[model samples]
Target chain A: MSLITPEFGLLFWQTLIFLLLLLLLAKFAWKPILGSLKEREDSIDNALKMAQQAKEEMQNLKAGNEKLLADARKERDQMLKEGQAMAAQFVEQAKTTASAEAGRITQQAREAIQQEKNAALAEVKNTAAQLSVDIAERLLRRELADPTAQQKLVDEYLKDVKLN
Target chain B: MKRLLTLLLCLCTFVGFAAEPAESGEKGGAFNPGEIILHHVADSHEWHWFSTDNGNFVTYLPIIAYQPGKGVAAFSSEKVAEGKTYGNFKLEDEKLVAIDGSKVYDFSITKNVAALAMSSLLLVFIFSSVAKSYRSRVGQAPSGLQSLLEPFIVFIRDEVGKKSIGPKYERYMPYLLTVFFFIWFNNLLGLTPGAANLSGNIAVTMALAVVTLLITLFSANKNYWGHIFAPPGVPWPLYIIMVPVELIGVLVKPFSLMIRLFANITAGHIIILSFISLIFIFRSAATGLISVPFGLFISLLELLVSILQAYIFTLLTAMYIGGAVEEHHHEEEHGHGEDFGTAEQRAGGSNVAHLNRPDVATH
Candidate 1:
């Protein structure tokens, strides 16, 4: 039947037209369209990958920053401890030097006072001896001066002196 | 949807009336639905839209015929109107025939040819511009026609191409996309009243199937040939039967592709025409109640089928290509090679099963 039959003319035209359409569309339509579609997809995928990488890099930088802060904090703590220790050491050294100087000054003053006291006591003893000696000499000289008067009396006492 | 239904209803009514008197007066004293349906479904030398008492509205195409000794004769089909003889040639049963018993080769540009050319141009224009927009838009969101057509292209690329054809899908994208759109567009175009049933024509579908077959056979790798000739784990003694079966499977795939599309489209047209023919057969105004609504329903269903058949064709094409180029893993060959062979057998077998099953009401 003509219903199922395929005429040569129609077949010829169908084949020719279909092939031409395929060739034309392949070169003109499908190539560029599919190419751009692929390019867009690749670019989108690349962008996502780059975004992931950037996020990771940001996290790394944050972690590095936190580590640096911690290190600085540790250094500050160590420095504060070292500074307190040095200040404590300086205070101890100053206290020891001040106490040592105070002891030396007190000992020197005590020695000076003792030497002054000895010197004054010796001078007082020497003056007192000289004064006693002058006073005794003066009293003896006065008694000798009274000896002439007594000589007359001695004539009376010659006999007693001779007897002595 | 309503609008389209109304338009379809008017067109179907117009077509039914046009063919009624012409068929009844020319053939018998009664209407012939078969003649009307076949006339509508088959290719013709002219594009007939409607007929009235005044004259018939048609476009006469160029008729080119060649005889072995007489050489080529070119003339407008209009010259052979009303069964008139033009030179030694005349129209006989919608064919250009030689008068003197000489063999004639008709190379006429029929209604289908013109429609094919028009659809081809339309395809070219739509896609070339979309391609241009892709160039211009570059990283921007698709707009208008680009956005509209992008999903279909991507669907064919992803669902039909990648999912069906695998990694080697890219190479077949052009052919796949072209065939899909070509079939889809023509199927929709054919649904409109009295339009040339270009997609429904056997010759057109045959050409498409042949191309798919050629591509499948040519692009097929060593693995495909191996499966066909040796069938992997099959006993060599069974090659006498298995080889022929495998080879028949190869030819049957494309043959079915051709017939499936041709039959489906042509059937749809026949069904709609038959529904419209009911009113005249009964010769009653009351038949309008039954005819119009049923015709409308079928036409709307046809809209869905047009795209569906196109998708099925392309999907199966992708599957065939995928099967052909598929590689056998070295591990599978040594360990579970028999199972692997049976798996391949199941795939090929299921496809044939799908083919043999009746299409039911969907077609």
Candidate 2:
């Protein structure tokens, strides 16, 4: 079956009715329809403008975020550099303190050893002096006890000793 | 330069043909309308000797015998008296003046209106497919045919109806869309083989132009009527002259539309046909060889023109609607002028009172 079966009489009537309907539409419906279209167009334009503004705002925020990130990175780098310098200074200070403590301990040990050596030498010297005194006394006593022989010897000695 | 050369060649060929006698002494031959119409309308496979199925009778229809030594031969019908052989042929004037041509007849082959019906069905099938796609999409985004049509629909809405009819554009959208599609579809169909005659008919164009006229008249605003009758700011004498002129302009606009479309489409068809007919006229192999390239070139140009004509018609119609519904800015200007005049009058009266002194005037 053909889709477009154009009946002449039918088409004529349809065309006439269509024309009349168009006239009616122009009279009654045109204004409201046009008004709605205008509103739609205006809304679309407004939407586009809003979208453009939002895009611009996003771009500005992106730029701000980039700058903040750069500043944060700079701060982190500065902190790292300062931390490295402080760590180096701390290590030097610790080494100086340890060396000073070691030197003081060694000096104190040397003084203590010298004091002990002096005490020991004085004690040895005192003992030797006592021993010598005792020995002299004993020899003198022996000589006194020998007096019996002394009389005879003295006569002979006096003659020889006249020169003393 | 090519086109000029072709024109010269055509003129030379026409003149040469005119110089030769029409009667190439072909016997029992006459021009038949049925043959002529059939020859023009149908697709010809090869040039052949056309004759009634009974072999005895022959006519002066130049038969391309399609043989090596005999490419073209004049055949005589048995209806002719028996002793005269093929040598009896002669040429008289530009037309094929047949010797012993005893009868004069005129007739035409009836065209099949069924073809037009078929064309309409084809149109419905194509558009229905597009329409079906649109319906299936429902609330979703348009795809396929809908995608193609949506832009054109939106273009009409945004560019033509909205911009032309202003606040009241919605009601006119349906009409505008119908007209644009109808005209464009018809124009495209007319480009197909055997379909050129429909658009060539003036009646079709007239009906379309009438629709445009009715829309403009009915949708016209108060400003449009005022401009037609009193036309603000024009002097009385000039206004009297302009009143009829503006009224006539209303009628003439649609009339011009009708003529422009009908003439352009018809003329293009005629020019293409005329170029194709050149091969038959020249009869020389060298001339026939040149016609092929030239005919193809002209056909290509016509294709571009066909689309262009449809666009121009639609665009102009939109412009006319824009003119009809647009508000008159001159009326506002007139009101401002009146206000300025009243202000000047008040100033003049105050100045006169301040300057009033009888004694000074008498002195």
Model 1 residue B278 CA deviation in Å:
2.5
Task: For each candidate, give its TM-score against the true structure.
Answer: 0.74, 0.48
Tens-place lDDT per residue, model 2, A46-75, is 989999999999999999999999999999
What TM value does chain A in model 2 reach? 0.49
Per-residue CA lDDT of model 1 for B1-363, tens digit only, reads 245236334423222111223423534576777887898899998778887665567767778899998898877777775688899999988988878868989988788987887788889989999999999999988888999999999999988887766546788999999999999999999998778999999999989999999999998999999988999888999999999999999999999999999999999999999988888889888998999999999999999999999999999999899888776665433332212233444467775654443221122
Which candidate achieves the best TM-score against the true structure? 1
CAPRI tier for the interface of model 2: incorrect
Roughly what TM-score does model 2 have, to 2 decimal places?
0.48
DockQ of 2: 0.02
* DockQ of each candidate, alpha-carbon based: 0.62, 0.02
